[model samples]
Structure formats: structure tokens, C-alpha cells
Target: MNTHRTAHRLVSRAATAAALATALGLGAVHTATASAPSAAPLSVRPAAPGPDGGWHQNGLHLTAAENKKVNGFVARARRAERAISPGVRAAARISHAELVGFDQRLKSPDSLKRKVATWMLESPGQTVDASLRKINDAVRFTLQWPAGTYSQGVRTAAGLLSAWGNDSTRWANTWNRPTGYKAINSAWRAPRSGQLFEVQFHTPESKAAQLETHKLYEEQRLPGTPPERVRELQEQQDAIFAAVPVPPGAERLTAPARRLPSPDPARRLPAPAPAPVG
Candidate 1:
């Protein structure tokens, strides 16, 4: 099965990575005891529209009308993104510095259009502005630490919330689990622009599992995927994540209390790649 093959490859890769790190004069690889570091996500420029004047990404093709809708959202998202990006990146850098120890990187700017497009396509009938607002992870960051420092990672996430609060950033939610998904996924609104962004906290094990399951999940989400095939893919993801040990007290993690309900009713699960236009 693919899962077993992935596991075998991961084990082999982890061994090679560790040995390479030592030989390169780098110290111990910073990751969960059981995991190897996954490759960083690649950033790519927006592709030209497909032959039909529609958009094509990862087998998801949008009609000209859909493409127009998608592009509108993309433009607005980009404007909002530009206004908030500097402050957000600074906050991430400072927070990680203050908290100390973890692997960190921001989502690439060029990746936003497809991300916004995919979100809009998955949820039809929502207006472009409302849909743009609902889009989170436009300026996301992932922080991964060793499993041994699980509690410390939890504390850092809390510390980030507290510090961002002082700077007037409002957070919408925090999901920490072995429950919904393996990592702690949270959305925060930028101080002045009010654009929503995500910050995820993970252990090396969960990160590796995420890396393994990401493509599988994206494929599962594509349109035209048979229901049974979708179920099978979901099961594959579930099994991979089921193997990641949950951090102690992870369930106790919470976002700062909100006075009004979240503007976001429920943010949908993130899909790193596009779903087909159905």
C-alpha cells in the first residue's frame, strides 16, 4: 500500500538526513525523535490561463466565468495581503525569536491566487468580498519543534497570542488536537488591515505526517474523485495521522476569548493544492 511505502521511504530519508546533517558539521537535526524534516513548500508564479481562457492548476480547470470570479478574489486578497504582510512577517520573526527554537517559514506570496481560487470554487454562492475575508492562510507560518518540547510549543503559541493582542491583532480560533487534525491551526486578524492569516504549531512527527498526507488530501478533495476513492484517501490520511503521538495537554490549548462570535462561521480545512472545477 502507498502508506507503507511512504513510511519506508520516510524512514530511509530520515536516516540519510541525519547522517548528512552530521557530515555537514551541523548539529543534531531539530525534529521529533521519530521524524525527519520534510522539505519546505515550494513557491511558484501564477500560471497562464488554460487554452480555453480558463484557469488550470493541479488538474482543476475553471471556466472563463469562474476564472474571472477567481481572479477578482485574487486581486482583493492580494491588496489586503500587501497591507498586512510587513507587520505579520515582523511579528512572526519576533515571536519565534522570543519563544526560542523551532523551524519557521512563511507561505509564498505567489501561491495565494490558487489558494483563494480553490476556496471560492469549493464554496460557491459566497460573494467575492465575503469569500476573500473567509480566506485564511494567505500569510501563514508553520513552526515545528521537537516532540520533547511539546509543552513549550504550546506555550509559545499562547505567548504569540498574548503578544499579538498587545499589538491589537485579533485571533479567531485555535484547533489543537489529535482530534480534528494533527496540528494546532489558528487564524489571526492583522492589526489594521483585518486580513485573516494562519499560524500552525507542530511537532516534527506531526509535520512529517502532514508532509506525507498533504498530497493525498489534496487529491481526495479534487472534483471527480469517486466517493469511494475519496473515502479511501481519507482513510489513508487518518491512518498516517493516527500514528503521530499527540502532545500532552494539547487539548487544553485555546484561543483568546472572543466578545462576539467569529466573523468566520467555521473556517474550512485547508487544502494546499487545487480541487478540479466540477
Candidate 2:
């Protein structure tokens, strides 16, 4: 995910530059509504130097062990991406009104009763796929969200960063790393329209405390599991990705992704937007 954030930083800068250039009339006028440039295509670039003076050529300069960690992480994230994409698309189709209302709730930051909905819906295939990409950037790659969920997501994302940054080998250790979240569950309400919601934590202490009662989920929870289950749970774990169909571009992850077996769909995939009190 750091890769996504770092990469998106590049995209955002490009978008801003494009906008600024157009605004200054230094180039042909472009509409503000014009689409921002897509983030760089997924490629294995070299790692840059580490602050500690260790090797890091872009993302490729990691030590052999670190490289394995990274590769393992990317493969897992990719598989998760593929598995979850369809679920996001499916949920979107089945719960359009709920998502619309949920989207509206996002505008109100301090609603005591109306917490911002975690589940977002988008059309399947391209729209959903693109949105997933953005979420990966927003959640996994970027450090954009509040800390608990953010850090937990980031540690998991570190593996992906290793991958996109060209250090796919880091994954095994990355996959084996402890996930901080206690549980992932959903809730539904029809206050105005059908809406689904979820909450994730950022604090390591909280996640660790929460993890005690939910240890069964640990193995399949992050990059440690197989691709098939990743797809299956993608819908339940993250409704946004669950609703979309996995794109052809997603194949690299699904096919050669993690070597683990698929977790059971029933256990891995929860119902739409329910709360996880644990």
C-alpha cells in the first residue's frame, strides 16, 4: 500500500501539475472535470536507498530475505484484490440505495448515531475495479485514514509495497506477520435507505486485544491465505471490492499469487456491512 500512496503521490502530483498547467494557460485549457492521470502501471521498479544506509534501489535493492518478504506480500495483496473485487461489485449491484445513503453519511463526520458507512458500492468491472485501485491507494498505499485502521492496513500493505516496489520476496515474512485487527464484521440499517457499514481499528494494542478472541481468522486474514478464498472473502471483508468483478489485470495475483489454499467462503465472507463488536 505504501507503494500505492507513494505511487499515487506521483499521480496526484501529476494531476495537480496538469491542473496547474491548464490554469496558468501555459498549455491548452483542460476542464477541471477532466480525468486525472491513472497511477503508474504496476511494474517492478528498483528500490531507493534506505535511511539506514542499507541497499534499496527503488524497491529492488532489498536484501534477498527482504525481497522474499516483499514478493510474498504483493502476491497476497494481489490475490486479495482479485478475490474481493467481485464481491464489491456484487454488493454494489444488490445494495445500490444503501451505498447511496452511506455515501451521504460520509459528509457528516460527527454523527453519533450515523457513523460513516465503511461499505462503499460501485458498478462492477471497470468502475469497481478502478475504485478498488483507488481504495488500495487510499487505504493500503496512502496513510490517508485514521491511525488504527490505517496502521493495521499499512503493515499489511507493506508487503504489497515490497511487491510493486520490486521486492516480492518479502511476502513470506510479511504474510506471517501478525495482523492487528480483532475482527471484521458488518451491520445493516434502513434508517432512510438500506445501508451497510463496517469499522476497522488502527491501534496495535486494540487490535492485539481484539485478536485474542478471533485467532481462528488469523491464518486467512491477511496475505497468508490462498487466492480463491481471497476472492470469496473480498466481498465480505471489504464490500467495496466485493461488488466488482475481478479484472483481467487481476490475473497475475489470482493465478500465481499466494500458494495457500482458499479459505471457506462462509467463514471468510461475512454478510453485508454488519458490525464486528469483538
> Candidates' lDDT values, in order?
0.50, 0.27
lDDT of 2 by residue, 62-105 (tens): 33444344344334443333222222222222211011111121
Cα deviation of 217, candidate 2, in Å: 31
> How far off is model 2, as Cα RMSD?
22.8
**Native-to-model Cα distance after best TM-score fit, residue 150 in candidate 2, in Å:** 21
Task: Using lDDT, give the best candidate's number.
Answer: 1
Best by TM-score: 1
Each candidate: RMSD to true structure? 14.6, 22.8
TM-score of each: 0.59, 0.20
After superposition, which runs of candidate 1 have C-alpha atoms over 4 Å from their true positions? Answer: 1-44, 51-53, 57-59, 63-124, 165-180, 258-278
Worst 10 residues of 1 by lDDT: 267-276
lDDT tens per residue, model 1, 25-93: 432222222211232223422356668877677654556766666566544544554444333333333
**Model 1's TM-score against the true structure:** 0.59
